[model samples]
Target: MTTQTQPIQAYSLPTPNGQKVHVMLEELGVPWVYHRIDIGKGEQFAPDFLAISPNNKIPAIVDPEGPGGEPISIFESGAILKYLGLKFGQLYPTDPRQQVKVDEWLFWQVGGFGPMLGQNNHFTLYAPEKIPYAIKRYGEETLRLFRVLNTQLEGRDYIAGDYSIADIASIGWAQSWERYGATRAEHPNVIAWIERLNARPAVARGLAFGKAS
Candidate 1:
């Protein structure tokens, strides 16, 4: 069913992880269509959706123009970013050392930064009962992670050597620092970085996608 001009099909919500793929497609200036998987209504658990994203997560995609000119489905935000970057020859660095730099930060986001922040949000906002230990535990970890990000961004403009997928991966999470009990004053560098990324037209558009609709 995928014709040459059939846009990439994105199945996602507007969560931070979802926004990563959205921002990547926009940044690459690619043609894409969104299929909102309403997590609240348990749409992510649908059998068809699970076939592509077995984890039942948002932000999976099906590229009509895949590596061998066939349809390909991909899950996980980080992997999706890498695949698109490679296909487009943009954002993802080609140089070995520079590429490593981007990979380091990108994995750091997927492994540590995003998960910790998610835990912080769950405990502080979504938890059924307010547990002091969980609140304190995740709260401190969130601050620590923000500190690491701020330090990494002290002198630089982006997370890695250049404005690569590393920055794209973390921008949405960083934008929600306040929701996780962190403040701008605590991480000035991160605040500045957020502003800088948000100022970009593509990023603004990507972040705004799915919000109005």
Candidate 2:
């Protein structure tokens, strides 16, 4: 007997992390219902949402047809991308070595690139009083990370192998390079990759969500 899968219930905002899942779902053509959690209004701290996302973050999902046919709630953007990829048999490689390549870049974004860039953004834009030290510190780190990514994309269209979750994980954060005090001129390969990903209809549609309609 075949068990039916239910539409994924996604609670998210339009931030970079949220966009990763949204774009992946769009690219995979997975059935999902999007619930916009307004972080500014503290909706993420609500009892219901907290139960699903213990970390009180956006981009959480409840997959009713999870492993063993049990409903499962997953938090963190990277985990969500991997789960969807594995379930849909798309956007992720079946080969062991190829999977490692994708996983490395994905983890790099989660651990190093995203945090550095986020700190740069906070100091540059949202921080009420800019400490020169903090700004310079994060800004330089962000640029260094950009250079690493640019080198990685020297001849490849995507980060790991093909257009996998690794690219999906990084694109949203890379899109905010301006806020991180980086420029396209310094990272031509990254710019080209961004354009390539942006050209996809699914990516465009995913980006359009949560925008004023």
Give TM-scores for every candidate, taking all chains together and pairing residue i with residue i: 0.95, 0.95
Q: Candidate 1, after superposition: displacement of residue 198 in Å? A: 0.4
Each prediction's whole-model lDDT (CA) = 0.90, 0.89
**Candidate 2, 137-176: lDDT as tens digits:** 9988989999999999999999996999999999889887
**Candidate 1 segments exceeding 4 Å error:** 1-4
**lDDT string, candidate 1, 1-213, tens digits:** 222366999998778999999999898887899999988899999999999999999899999889788899999999999988888889998899999999999999999999998988899889999999999999999889999999999999999968999999999898877776667787889989999999999999888899876
Worst 10 residues of 2 by lDDT: 1-10
- At residue 212, give the lDDT of candidate 2: 57
Ten-residue region with minimum lDDT total, candidate 1? 1-10
